[model samples]
Target: MANLFLIVLAHVTVTAVVMLLWLARTYMKLKGELQVLKNSVQKNDQYLAGLSSSARAADSRLAFIDEQLKGLSAKLSAFQQNEQSANPYNAIIQKIRHGASVEELMRDCSLCRDEAVLLMRLHGSGPG
Candidate 1:
């Protein structure tokens, strides 16, 4: 009877030892997987942070471009206004805007007939 009890106890102890070893192996695998997941998350976070900063820099560049465009538009508007007020082309346009006829100005002016006609066309109003 004493020998039978010792044999049974020994079997139970061996079984318990095997179970502890299996649990330890499973715990190590789980810990390795958790570490890998944490590393992936950290890398993605760093990449996202860099991307956000780059986006902000791009936004600032776009704003600068927009300001330059507005300044150019203002200069263009001023140039067009000056053209309307100063150029010979503008004088011709204004004469044409008034009611004087191109043919009449050519006749009265001493310019050669063809030259008169050309000048009249250039600076005088259309026949009306």
Candidate 2:
């Protein structure tokens, strides 16, 4: 009976030691996986930060372009108004549309020969 009791005690001790070793190995593997996850999260955070900065820069550039477009629109509006007020070719256009000759446009509208010909091509009654 004493030998039976000793044999049972030795078996229990060996089983407990094996279970503890398995627990240790599992803990080590889980800790290594946690560390890898942490590193990946850090890299993702850095990449997101860079993207955020780039987005900010792009927003600034877009704002600058918007301002430039507004300025160009205003300039175009002013130029269009000036062109409406200062048009010098209305009479020449009318004469060309009425089938006036290039020589007549040059003589009456004080246009050069090339200017008369170009006007005829653009606004004349006949094909040019």
Candidate 3:
């Protein structure tokens, strides 16, 4: 009968509408989740970039420190060479500190007795 057919048609239309609404809600939830994932990935990329920059800066500083140390080493070597060659008094002081007598200092260092006596009194470890 026509009445039976119309009742069946109305039930089908209501069921289809409910199915469509459920599908739309599911789509919205999936879209929100995708957005959250994208944001997390962007933050991770920024953090990695900052770490890379810091590592490069540290490497540069280390290189500068290495060059400064090399320069200081060279200057120290030159100063030592100059001191050894320029100062005979350094050797005389070593002899005096080792308890050399005035006579030995005068004979070996070509110093006058008065000068030898004065050095011994000033720098000798033992009795002058």
Candidate 4:
């Protein structure tokens, strides 16, 4: 009866040791996996930071381009206004194209004689 009791005790002890070894192995594997996950998280953080910096730079460039476009739009408006004010005799030129005489251009456009003759020479169908 004493020998049977000793055999049972030894079996339990061996089983306990085997279970501890398995537990230790599992803990080591989980620790390795956790380290890999930490490295991946750090890489992702660095990539995100770079993207943030690039986005800020792009935003500044876009703002500058917007300001330039506004300036160009203002200049285009001023140029259109100047062109409208400068060519008040477009109707008289069209009339001259239809063979209107210099005297007719002077009468219709209220221009001086020299201005009418110049328009006739420039836009008329034939020589002034």
lDDT for each residue of candidate 2 in 1-128, tens digit (9 for 90 to 100): 99999999999999999999999999999999999999999999999999999999999999999999999999999988887678867767877877889888888888888888888988885533
lDDT (Cα, tens digit) per residue for candidate 3, span 1-128:
89999999998999999999999999999999999999999999999999999999999999999999999999999998899789867888898887788888889999998888788777885545
Candidate 1's error at 42, in angstroms? 1.3
- Deviation (Å) of 11 in candidate 2: 1.7
Off by over 4 Å in 1: 1-11, 87-120, 123-128
TM-scores, all models, native as reference? 0.61, 0.68, 0.55, 0.67
The global Cα lDDT (0 to 1) of model 4 is 0.88
Give the alpha carbon lDDT tens digit for every residue of 19-117 in model 4. 999999999999999999999999999999999999999999999999999999999999988876799877787798788887777787788899988
How far does residue 105 in candidate 3 sit from its true spot (Å)? 12
Clashes of 1: 0
Query: Candidate 1, after superposition: displacement of residue 101 in Å?
Result: 13
RMSD values for the candidates in order, in angstroms, are: 7.7, 7.2, 6.2, 5.9
lDDT, model 4, position 91:
71
Best by TM-score: 2
Q: Which pairs clash inside model 1? A: none
State the C-alpha lDDT per candidate.
Answer: 0.76, 0.89, 0.88, 0.88
